[model samples]
Target: MTLKQQLTDDMKTAMRGGDKHRLGVIRLVLAAIKQREVDERIELDDAQTLAVLEKMLKQRKDSVSQYEAADRQDLADVERAEMTVIEAYLPAKLDDAELDALIAAAIAETGASGPRDMGKVVAAVKEKAAGRADMAVVSGKIKTRLAG
Candidate 1:
């Protein structure tokens, strides 16, 4: 099934199982997906849906960090739980070695020799990595590779 369909199915399962937390998170995801579709006037494919999931995951991670910094363990735990739920929908992430290999290949493919070419290399890496790797990490790696 498509990712959207899977979400819907899981939502129904959550309801049947009386899983309040899971149901809430699933609804939040579906709502975000629907809002994006309405705003863009188009249905999102799997890749686009994954993008939304990644964005939500990033926001949750930020919230977790901020809550922890403020000594709000309860809030941080909630965010962490939400993040775990969100991560279940994402594709398998690339390991460090695999990610490095992809970065190296992107740099070579784009002929990126210095920091000035960072954008080109990043665009290439983002296209290849997409949901498989974090863009922030990829960009950092690209910067280091280009600068050194």
Candidate 2:
């Protein structure tokens, strides 16, 4: 089944299980996906759906940090909960060694030689990550490799 269908099935399960927290998060995810489809006038494939989930995860991460910095642990906890639910659908995150290998491969594949080639390397790695990478971290690594 498609990712969207999986989300719908999980939503029903959560409802029947009386898991309000999970149900709310799932609804929010579905709403976000629907909004994107309405705005773009196209149905999202699995990759595109994954991209939306990643975007939501990033937003939740940012909110969690900001809430904590503002001394609002309660709010931060809510964001963290939402993040966990959203992350359930994403692929397993890459570890440091794997990420480094992927970056090296991207750089080599792109024939990236210097800082001027940063975009190509980043694009290659981003494609490999399927929009799942923390771009800030990836770009920093790419810059260091190229500039050094």
| lDDT of each candidate versus the true structure | 0.94, 0.92
Error of 2 at 132 (Å): 3.9
Question: Hey, what RMSD does candidate 2 come out at?
Answer: 1.1
Tens-digit lDDT string for candidate 2 (23-120): 99999999999999999999999989999999999999989999999999999999999999999999888877888899999989989999999999
- What range of 10 consecutive residues in model 2 has the weakest lDDT sum? 127-136
lDDT of 2: 0.92
Candidate 1 regions exceeding 4 Å error are none
Top candidate by TM-score: 1
